[model samples]
Target: MATQGRSTLDRRRFLGLSAAGAAALGLGMAGSAAAQTPSGASRMPPSIAALGPVLGKAVPIADDEYRARLAKAQRLLAEQGMDAVFIGAGTTLRYFVDLNWWGSERTAGVLLTRSGDPIYITPEFERSRAMEQVRFGSEIRTWQENQSPFDLIARTLRDRGIATGTLGIEEQLPFFMADGIGKAAPQLHLVSATPVTAGCRAVKSEAEIALLQIANDATLACYHAVWQALQPGMTQQDVQALVAQAYGRMGVRGFVDINVGKYTAQPHGSIEPQKIVEGTVVILDDGCQVHGYTSDITRTFVLGKASDKMKRVFSIVQQAQIAAREAARTGGMMGDIDAAARKVIADGGYGPGYKYFTHRLGHGIGMDMHEWYYAVGDSRQPILSNMTLSDEPGIYIPGEFGVRLEECMVTTPAGGRWFTPQSPSIELPFG
Candidate 1:
């Protein structure tokens, strides 16, 4: 998939991927036959050990793409009648400028005007560091200690001939920063930048879809490999170790939460110790990233064999997932998609609304796992082509077990399409 790739060191710094963390997850080098106890390497089955890196075709987003994104945002700002948008030091910042800055007490961000170049803001001490990753713009205004960065922002705006109109603030900006800006520039009206930011981000470009595809494919492969290596008596932690090892073998950092038996009834699972046994359900949830795009998949199955009830629930959930996908047509209301899926689950004896299906059908997936817009009952947001989202429908029955089948999908004129094929059955999840 076409994604923006970073060096392993950079990815580690950004994602906080550590050898110790990996080792804790039971990750080890591939093709090593020597069994070492006390480490997860000893438990690493031959199926997982034989896997190799699949990131050879992964590509990084080019500087031109970042510039294009800025251009689109600028157009949106003009159309929305906003003079400029203040983007904070997080995913929105990274999305537009390719800068992976960590937010702190200090103020740092970008002020993009509708008519001119993007202006970056940062601490004077971190000017050089900011420059290294500021891929879209050249003008960076810095602030010194004991000085108000908010004042600097006001000054920058006035200098750009934007002294008195509405200013859109990135939705994720800290409250203190927003309040500070309001006090410093009482002449400016602040509003949410969702119209501009989400307008640009909600839909995926071909390159981004490719990246998401690779990410989802990698996660599915990891699940398949780990499923083959499962054994009785393995704890949830042991399975997590195997998942980590599988991703490590594929040369990507990933994560998963495991639930065994009745614990699978919990949507997010529990930290309470769980062990696999015959005829019990097990749930593996979460996924990995390729470049910056992410994949979120959940697979529920059994180590030995599923009971008749388990099979029935699985079939209903799977059908609901498919119904949601088929209803996700471009120009259709987002709520309609959720309704279609909920109807399937309800008819199958699950819910009237969020009773057995406890949460929304799915959420938008992109650079962040959960982004703007969602597939839920109350949303009236219009589905658009190239928009990527999750088609996850789950039925949770407390004190027993639960079934959830999730697959990230993309919207098209023909409806929704999955990045990877859906789980064929509980016993053949990867298929």
Candidate 2:
């Protein structure tokens, strides 16, 4: 589940340990004393306090990977019949050039031609800052404060011999930028860059998968620790605090949205104050990031014993998750995956499509929490190998409780494999 607000706990604020240092400290062992909560009323449990960083196996995307990504984008441009592609300062730019730039009123991005090096456009004053992060490109074009950056973009395209062909604009690029560029280059046609950007990003490389795996593993570990630490009378905020502390102990920044009792029925959660009690259902959603890659997992359980109805609902949701996973084979239609999960939920008595299963089966997951190629009944996109997605199936019953089981999965030649095992039961969520 996605939350509107996030409270991040920097790893450095707690352990501040390097990956090697964390490994030496030992995994599954308590490294330091528990820190007091912001209210100074409680200390974290031993399970959470014992958590240690698990990023030792994680490797950031290397320079070669960036170059290869650029190569793939260029190949996609050529195949799509576009002269050059404009990548604004965002994830798309980061994906190709390794430039972690923020977009503002001023324009800053890269222009990749069909046959030449990438041309970076930025304000004249920010050129030095852009230089620090441009790992793959060299030709930097600058526009003074009095000049128009769109004009600079048009001229750069002409300089690269792209006089009158189609130019693919990054889908997330601002409308003003696109409109300005269109007006500046009336001869060139502007089109969506999804065919090129999503074409390359939707597929995950082995290295990307490895990073995602570790991120998911770390999140599950944090969840397990937090679950062990749960107690009666803890507020929803307290549980969220525990989650942040667990990630802090693990030496990674993370966030979570805590939902209790009837509020759990709301997929994104509620802002009302909620207290945990015996037999009350609690749902923990969201996950941490490892090397800019994200992991999203949701676990629902009770602090004490679960009622019979809750168990039955949990089982149905679990089965739905499995059904969706089984249907996510390479070459299968993406819609089929959603249909498979919805069928299980409906057949289990929550029928008539979207009645209880409130949302789509899952969404594409990678650097961003929600990406391309979603798994919805109306989607007809083909599921391909190496595509990573979430297999989240939920049953929300208003004024009662909801059960959602989410796990990130990668599509393999064999089929879809989850980064972590599905929750066995409500009582034993991590299993």
Top candidate by TM-score: 1
Q: Write the per-residue lDDT of candidate 2 for residues 1-431, one digit (tens) a residue.
A: 55221112222222222222222322322233545542454465778777887887789999999889989988999899988999898777877887889889898899998776788999999989988877675788899999999999999888888789999999888999999999999999999999999999999999999999999999999899989878888775566666667887887767677778998898876667788888988888777789888898999999779999999999999999999899989988889999999999999999889999988888888887778878998788988999999999999999999999999999876669999999988987876
Q: In lDDT terms, how accurate is model 2? A: 0.83
- Runs of candidate 2 with Cα error greater than 4 angstroms are 3-34, 37-43
Question: Can you give the TM-score per candidate against the true fold?
Answer: 0.93, 0.92
lDDT values for all models: 0.82, 0.83
Candidate 1: worst 10 consecutive residues by lDDT?
1-10
Candidate 1 C-alpha lDDT tens digits along 1-431: 11122111123222223322545444444223443222344556767777888789888787888888999999999899999999988888888988899988899999999876789999999999988877666899999997999999999999999889999999989899999999999999999999999999998888889889999998898888888888888876566667766877788877676778887887876657788887899888777878888888889998667889999999999899999999999989899899999999999999888889988888888888788678888789999999998899999999999998899899998889999898988877876
The local lDDT score (0 to 100) that residue 195 gets in candidate 2 is 92
